[model samples]
Target chain A: MRQANLEEETAVLGFLEAMEKGLSMKVLSGGALGVVERDGIQFAVLTSQALLSLPQDLLAGAEAAGLPLGVLEGDGFHLDLQGAALVAVHTKAQTCRVTEQAAKLFLYGRNVLGDSVVWHEPGLKRGDACIVCNGRGESLGLGVVVGPFKGMREAVKPVQDLGTYLRDQDE
Target chain B: MTEPDFPVARFAAGPKIREWSRKHGFSDWMVARILQLTDRPADVLEGLLHRPPRYLRANPLRASVEEVLSRLEAKNFSLARNELDPNILKLRQAPISPGATIEHMQGLTTPQDLASASAPLALGAQPGDIVADLAAAPGVKTLHVAGDLAGGGLRERGAIIAVEPDADRMRALRFNLERCGATSVVMRNHTAQELPGKAWADRVLLDAPCTGEGTIPKDKNRRHGKPEEVTAMAALQRELVDAADRILKPGGTLVYATCTFAPEENEAQVSRLVGKGYRVEPLGFDRVASVPLVPGVTQWPGLELDPSVARARHFLPGVHPTLGFFVAKLTKRERAI
Candidate 1:
């Protein structure tokens, strides 16, 4: 089921709050992968590897703590985020997953929070992308990165009131 | 008991298909999908269809490999040691179902998960050390460790405490212990998390509870699990970890491992432990490339994993060419208290 926009905003706020306390977070937004925060903004807006690389135990643990769960079927994956759920596909990679349609909303929310966020499409590797699927289509491995640095070591923390941080900034 | 929606029978041939893909280099993703559908990979499927079935290794703890091989040979059952577990002998030829053999029904052998045996071995165990297998029910790995302990000649000095909370499984655990002849061990039905004191043992193995996502090939019933169940299991895992931390002795080693592929459960949990102050050891995958560790979580092919988290390990089916699994070893330091 798609999450409401309010849930997306709340989740984003929660994620940022958790990152501020030294946790790292990966959020699925608008069919892209991003590290929401790492070590209290020390490494913000960083690109990350596909979510598939993380250990299953950690992901299952996090999903219990409220991170989204992505399901892989014949076509791609399905993700459950706070915002409206999204469907992502790597045409070239023959991969797809569900995501939170919060990328745009989060970008807009971050603008309201007044934090400087950058937008960049991490270049694709020659043989890394899937062939059965086109560049538009992604492999089950397609993902986005969002953090303060390139390789952050902190674990992703679940934030309790990111909405408060966003609200305070909005005011 | 009510029947499982998806049954074990559905996964009987998974091992055959997986073996074929490895020899041919079929893309792992493709192989997994096809297996889910029960479509045999064309290359090796034909051979498997014509071969007679065989199973061996009737509890290595009780009988010698040579003895078992001789017995099987006498019975005209072709037995070949599994490359993964030398104790496990695959059937090259057999006149009857191996599990029905007198050796098997008498608790001489069980169809154990081969990957499960690797976790305790990864600990670099020596004789005379105290080792604990957390969540050890039906004690497959516990027996494996017992076998290792015997092989390591730690019989006089080494001891194993097999812990499991489930009542039903504890019975099976006892049965396995007896059959495996791992007598230099303690069996406890209590939860590992509930252990009374800190820094309790020199080593601890937590085959933590997981969604069993990777077991889909062998445990077909796993595929139908709902998302909510995954979330609940995750929460339980965190609690179990918290308990594990409290009981592990300072400077002691712990193997936090699982049988799932979700990042949240594997690498993510390791990250949490590192945040709590355990030191991860360096684990290299080059030596075991065919069954390489998961990236971002393994000690080798090292990257920016939490400095403390670096001591942990993670495994996958595609990389490992085995059942998807994860293992991380952490050495507890002196507690501040």
Candidate 2:
């Protein structure tokens, strides 16, 4: 693996901290990290081991530093979740809850349609990254807000599932 | 399309084979070799001309095989489960593009060929085993090993060292591995030959690059490859096999596979390994279920392969609904004290 310089490392740490906050959970450490840019899209790849072992204090410190973090609409930060405990510690107000059927579709990389959303945070708007949970409150993945919540059938047009990070069709 | 004539007597020298090649837009040389390799030349030609059903191996790391199948079926997508490997499903119909389906994008399923899925199955790396994929770029099989080593769970305990020499390919490989949710892999941007002998693995998979003759049906350019090019691939394959041998622990299994039908690259290469004290073993396809596989050829012009080479399996496009593939399983003999 190519080594990342100090700037790249800092950028990655900041991005990860932001993701942790977005998901409302702390990431463990003990894995490795690398950053690479391809075709104008930057990707931060964290090994599954690292994700499993990330310390909460380390992320807290990074957040405290107020590192400038920005994810362009087209860029991605990928984390290996194998063996990583993704506990949804935040309250229900912070999550977008979908039906059991919708949860299956969401995990399959489908956007969570408005009709499928059982509940959601009160103030979600377009392009807000929020945690997508199932009826049982398990974290399905992260979602990008595409439309505002209106009602049972009118709120949250479609939430982009986090699985899109792995959808590289270049091969 | 009208069916081609069957049982062409003297197919090796007959005009029928050439006529069939011209009719099917294949190189005459490839058709002639197919005729010589199998008695059912017509079937092989038909299989090549026809597009095989697309297969997807459900990523067990993300979802159960049953869950994936049920979701696809609920969406009205046509699918049939492989009895031998529960993870494999043949797509009979789809409401949307199979590759673009939500299941595919979510890493719940991967578009893979039936033959390509067999290499990992043949290796059968148990949980917590250290495995090495010598040529793992665009790592479909590497992901398979990772998923299997984890026992089809999100928690990965086993490790896989994926070695790909090409920089450009490594980029795509990393993308695929991430997409598939394969967290157990350690990507190394170096050739298999560079792996130190001390970094031994419990199992090694050498899906060596080859002339790709078997994929000609899917990739027409393979039909135009020169014979010398096949010889060149054989030379490289020998180097890769040597490296695999060096890094494989004693009594460890090594599965050598290729997407080509050239004897110089397949049987002859395995013969060389046997010469070096590697024992040929059954691919154990039957242990799973009945998959279409013909025995590896032992006799080819200018090459005398060991009889044990017959234990290896050859998956011809004609005999199986898959691209042409050859797989051989071998175990390195323990050295004497």
- Candidate with top TM-score is 2
| DockQ value of candidate 1 | 0.01
Candidate 1 off by > 4 Å: A1-171, B1-60, B82-85, B92-95, B105-108, B152-156, B283-293, B296-315, B318-321, B334-337
Go through the candidates in order and give each one's DockQ. 0.01, 0.15
lDDT of 1: 0.47
* Candidate 1 Cα deviation (angstroms), residue A110: 77
List the global CA lDDT of all models: 0.47, 0.68
Residue B89 miss distance in model 1 (angstroms): 3.3
lDDT tens digits by residue: candidate 2, A82-132: 211133433454468888788767766676778788787777777766677
Candidate 2 chain B, run of 10 with poorest lDDT: B1-10
TM-score of 2: 0.76
Model 2 lDDT per residue over B116-219, tens place: 88899899988778788999978889888888887755646656777888887887776677656665666667788877654368899999998898887788
Give me the TM-scores for chain A across all models, comma-separated.
0.17, 0.51
Tens-place lDDT digits, model 1, residues B1-337:
1211221112233665456656644333334432342222352233222312223445655566676778668889886665546777666787876654535432346555445655766665555566777788777777677667656331223556667788667766654554333444555567766555556567788888887766655554554455455456666777777777876678877788888754455656676778788777764332233433434443212122465553454444433434556677777777687
